[model samples]
Target: MSHDAIVLCRLDELVEGQALGFDPLGTGKDSVFALRHGGEVRVYRNSCPHLEVRLEYRKDRFLSVDGSQIICYAHGARFLPDSGLCVYGPCLGQSLSALRWHAEADWLVLEAGQLEACAP
Candidate 1:
């Protein structure tokens, strides 16, 4: 992967409508989630908007039933695929903070200046 690009798992490793957390670029508790929906991939901070904590059922597991929505294991909040908008729970109309990335040469490259501080 390029220095500016995120290390996207191989297509064989990620099924549709699933999300996996990526380690922080450096060393920290902070991390990002790479979500796959159809043929598109969206990246966001791994924290749930409702509680600002990591959301996963297990290691790198962050998908809701039917594998169509992102679910917060902390409080069961649901977010829409692709948009990252909260569709239920206390988050209401809020959205997950996104990081911009592009697929190049079969890798997901995190765009320059696109990383942002996530809500805490």
Candidate 2:
């Protein structure tokens, strides 16, 4: 139940119904993005399952117009906001990769050790 965690951001920074991208490794590209949905924060790897490409059309633009679904700009796939499940386009039935995280106080923390284990 103990691990070294890295704070992604203050919870308030994650605006409701909007996507916020994070470059955890300082790679000059976003490795993941977070969204606030139904009073919860959901974090997902930025990659599109169809082609393994980053999903955003531009910085932090992961959701469709009106912010209802996750849109993979590279492949035109649509995913359920809460579940990351691709429901349309080429990768239908495939899901975006979710990262392990939990909110602590006013911050969102990625469970770091597990993330290291999962990193390529």
User: Using TM-score as the measure, which candidate wins?
Assistant: 2
**Model 2, which residues run further than 4 Å from truth?**
1-3, 116-120
- Residue lDDT tens for model 2, 26-106: 678888889988877899988888978889989999998888999998878999989999999999899988998987888
lDDT of 1 by residue, 33-112 (tens): 78779777788888888868887878778887688888888898998878889999989899988887766666666664
Off by over 4 Å in 1: 1-3, 26-30, 116-120
TM-score attained by model 2? 0.90
What C-alpha lDDT does candidate 1 achieve relative to the native structure?
A: 0.74
- lDDT of every model, 2 decimals: 0.74, 0.85
